[model samples]
Target: MERIYLDNNATTIVDPVVKEAMDPFYCQMYGNPNSLHSFGTEVHPYMKIALDRLYSGINARDEDDILITSCATESNNTVIKGIYYSLIRTGRKSQVITTQVEHPCVANSCRFLESLGTDVVYLPVNEDGIVTPEILREYINPDKTALVSIMWANNETGLIFPIKELCKVTHENGALFHTDAVQAIGKIPVNVQETGVDFLSFSGHKFHARKGVGGLYVRKGTDLPTFMHGGEQMASRRAGTIDVPGFIGMGLAMELAVRNLEYEATEVRRLRDKLEDAILSLKDVLVVGRREIRTPNTILASIRGVEGEALIWDLNRSGVAASTGSACASESLESNPTFVAMCISDELAHTGIRLSLSRFTTEEEIDRSILVIRQSIERLRNISSR
Candidate 1:
């Protein structure tokens, strides 16, 4: 059986080009970027090139700070906690605002902040799983809100949020705006300057870069407090030695991913739509979120009378990789939270399964995946009805 991996949103296979770019950094050019020795300093030019690629990929300003971290989780934690220490702790503000459909990293950070006595408001998303600027205005108070964090694209339903409009609202209220763009960077055009966002977080693995590498984009003059404390690395903004290989790979990955955004929008979307249309042809199946508003590579569908985990297992047995929802929440064996947040019924909520694609996804794989999914659903439903 040919294995069809449709879980790109969870993580992607590192592009061969990116891997090749990073190979030399492992043992050949191994050096601490912060070291003054020749071995270390010699890597500077390559590092600079990588940094430039990263900046150009995001359209970030020269004066802005891009702090490399372990992954999007670290980047998220840094922005949330940094805001807590810098603004809320210092009496500048007392509350943080975020949507209910956020990934566990952002959601849990808010939950943690709540325990620390910071007012954390999880704004509800509409039936489409979107937190519009109007919804934000209802909860964000200029006097109390220190920061508002929202993800640019939902991992479960692939719903794209209105980042620019939401950021404008947050800024108008004198609060900083941050977005977890982990799912959005490669899938969409993410120009930080155009969004006027104060901070952004992204993971390299989500975009065909190696794991263990991600970054935080802090706008100039943001005054974010330090999240890590140790070496003078990252200009003392973020501590610890840099992952030179990971950085090189991720930078090139970002550049390449952005370069193929057109293909992502056209070819990827066509394949996704083909798969989605086939899934919808099945009885009692509905895709979450409007296809027009979602990222081109994702489909979260609810198949009535079929349990999500059962469907996932059946798909796996057929050599097709899929998920029930966010990979981070998969072990919990619970219903899809994003479905619940969108006010989907308990029955359909538990039936939600997500099939995400990537730039590398092929039309043949989509066709095969659709067949496997249809067979799996039919078998699962037959068993349950028996």
Candidate 2:
């Protein structure tokens, strides 16, 4: 049986081209970038080239602005905790602001900070999972605000936030801004210079690269305490021996994504709408984030009278793969915080199923997925009614 994987938001299959680009590094080009030998020196250029590619992909001002890390979790922790520690030492600012719909890494980071007596504010989002600039402006206090961390795009609903405007508001209020762009990067254009974000975090696996590689963009002159302590890797901003092969794969994957961005936006979005429309035609199903500005490849639909996990299991048996919410929070039985924050009823939240696509997702798979979901929902609802 052929499987139709629709969980791109959780992670993506590594592109063949990216894998090819990384193959040599695993055996022939394996060398620690920090080493001074020929083996290391020869491998060093690849890392630099990867950094340059990432810089170009995001339109970052300088290559030095990028700090390589293991994943977006580390990047988020580094930015939020680093800023808090750095500012507390100087007795300048004490507040951090973020949204309730942010990924667990970011949301939990704020919670941890709050426990430590940091004034952390989790701004609420609209029903469409959006945090408007107006809402941000209201919470921002220049005198006490040190940083504002928000996500560029939501992983579940695929809703795109106004990062550029939010960054401007934060700066005007005398605070720095950070955006977790893990789901936004590659799928959309991200120009750090244009957005003026002080810090940005993104993971490679979200965009067809290896899982162990990720990057953080920090504006020049933005002072923050280092998250890791070790050798002079990532300009000493992050300390650890870099994953050479993973970085190579990420660079190639990002290069491909930028080159095909337009096609992904148009074609993928068309396919997503087709799937959504078909699914919505079924009775008693509501599309989450339907009216919001969303990314090209996600659809979160709540199927009434059916449990999300059970429906997903049925879909899996039918060769269709989907999700209930963030893979990071999949182990929990509670409703997703994103839906809860939107004030969605417990019944709807528990029935919400997320279907995310990728450039490789074909129209045939989408059609099959729609059919499978409709059948699964019908079967589950019938069973529930009985």
Q: Write the per-residue lDDT of candidate 2 for residues 267-370, one digit (tens) a residue.
A: 99899989999988988888877534888898988888887888888999999888885322366655688878876666667788889999999989998888
Best by lDDT: 1
Q: What's model 2's overall lDDT?
A: 0.87
Candidate with maximal TM-score: 1
Query: lDDT of each model, Cα atoms only?
Result: 0.91, 0.87
Cα shift from native, residue 371, model 2 (Å) = 1.6
Q: What is the TM-score of each candidate against the true structure?
A: 0.98, 0.96
Position 111, candidate 1: lDDT = 94
